[model samples]
Structures are given as structure tokens and as C-alpha cells.
Target: MATPTTSTGASNKLLLAIIAIFLPPLAVALKEGLTGTFWLNLVLTLIFFIPGIIHALLVVL
Candidate 1:
């Protein structure tokens, strides 16, 4: 049986993954805080959108 925290975490991941498909940087920020990955995602998003989405999905999942 999954604990409440586990269930919530899973749901949060799912939501972040969905968001990653759209706003990659925001998703990365949510998952990883304002760290290097967030900045990397922002740069990737500015350079090319698809790579940012891919990176964000990788980070989230």
C-alpha cells in the first residue's frame, strides 16, 4: 500500500511531466528548484523548444 506522501509525490510527478510537455522551464523549476537544471532548461528553451521539453521530462521522470 502506498503511503499518502508517496501517492502525492507520484501525482505531483505526473503533473510536472504534463507541464514539462508545455512549459519545460517551469516544470524543471518545480521539480529541481532554482538550480543549474532550471537555468539549463531556460537556456535550452530560449535556444530551441523541443530540447527544453526533453530535458525537463528527463529531469522530472
Candidate 2:
């Protein structure tokens, strides 16, 4: 059987946003795998506030 997935939710979202703001790569690495999401998260963080990147990463993760 396939393994079930888990989510951290909005609270995690806020956490991730804070992480993304100050931690950057750590937040992205937590939410997204090293492949695609990494670059995307980096770009989003660069383009928008850490919150935006955090929101995206939270949903994607």
C-alpha cells in the first residue's frame, strides 16, 4: 500500500512564512523537495514577501 501523506496546516503556514522570511532555504526545503519546489520557492521569496512564498510552499508541501 502507498503511504499516507500528512499536512502541517495554516499554523505551519505562519511558521513557514517566518522561516522563509528569515530562514529562506530552510523553509523551502521543509515544504518542497530539492527538485522543482526549491527553485520555485526561491523565486517566489525573491519576488514577493516571505508570506507569499510561505503560503505557496505550505499549499504545495
Candidate 3:
């Protein structure tokens, strides 16, 4: 049995994970806000796209 909030959070995470595959920075920002993680993700994306995706996944999940 899952609480409503728990299920909703799971769904949100799934959606963000899908978005992270495409736009890692956006996904990080959505999950973590425009914080240092967001800045780091942007920098990682500029330096190497794959690292950015990996970082975003770590932050989100």
C-alpha cells in the first residue's frame, strides 16, 4: 500500500528521470531548485554531456 504523497513522488521522480535523459540541467533544477547542483550540472553539461546526465541522475534519484 502506497500513500498518495509517496506515489506522487515516485511518479514525479520517474518523469524527472526521463527528462534528465534529455535535459539534465533542467531535471536537476526541477528536483533540486536553482542551487549549486543546478550550476554544477550546467557546467558538467558544457564540459561533457554524459557526465551531466550522470550527475543529474545522482541528484534526482
Highest TM-score: which candidate?
A: 3
TM-scores vs. true structure, each candidate? 0.88, 0.48, 0.90
Q: Compared to the true structure, candidate 1 yields what TM-score?
A: 0.88
Candidate 3 residue runs with Cα over 4 Å from true position? none
State residue 46's C-alpha deviation in candidate 2, in Å. Answer: 11
Global Cα lDDT for candidate 2: 0.64
Tens digit per residue, CA lDDT, model 1, 6-57: 9999999999999999999999999889999999999999999999999999
The model with the greater TM-score, 2 or 3, is 3
In model 1, which regions exceed 4 Å deviation?
none
- For 1-61, candidate 2 gives per-residue lDDT tens digits of 4333324365677787676667676677777768676776667766876555565556444
Per residue, candidate 3 scores C-alpha lDDT tens digits across 1-61 of 9999999999999999999999999999998899999999999999999999999999989
Candidate 3, TM-score vs. the true structure? 0.90
Task: List lDDT for all candidates, in order.
Answer: 0.97, 0.64, 0.96
> Between which residue pairs do clashes occur in model 3?
none
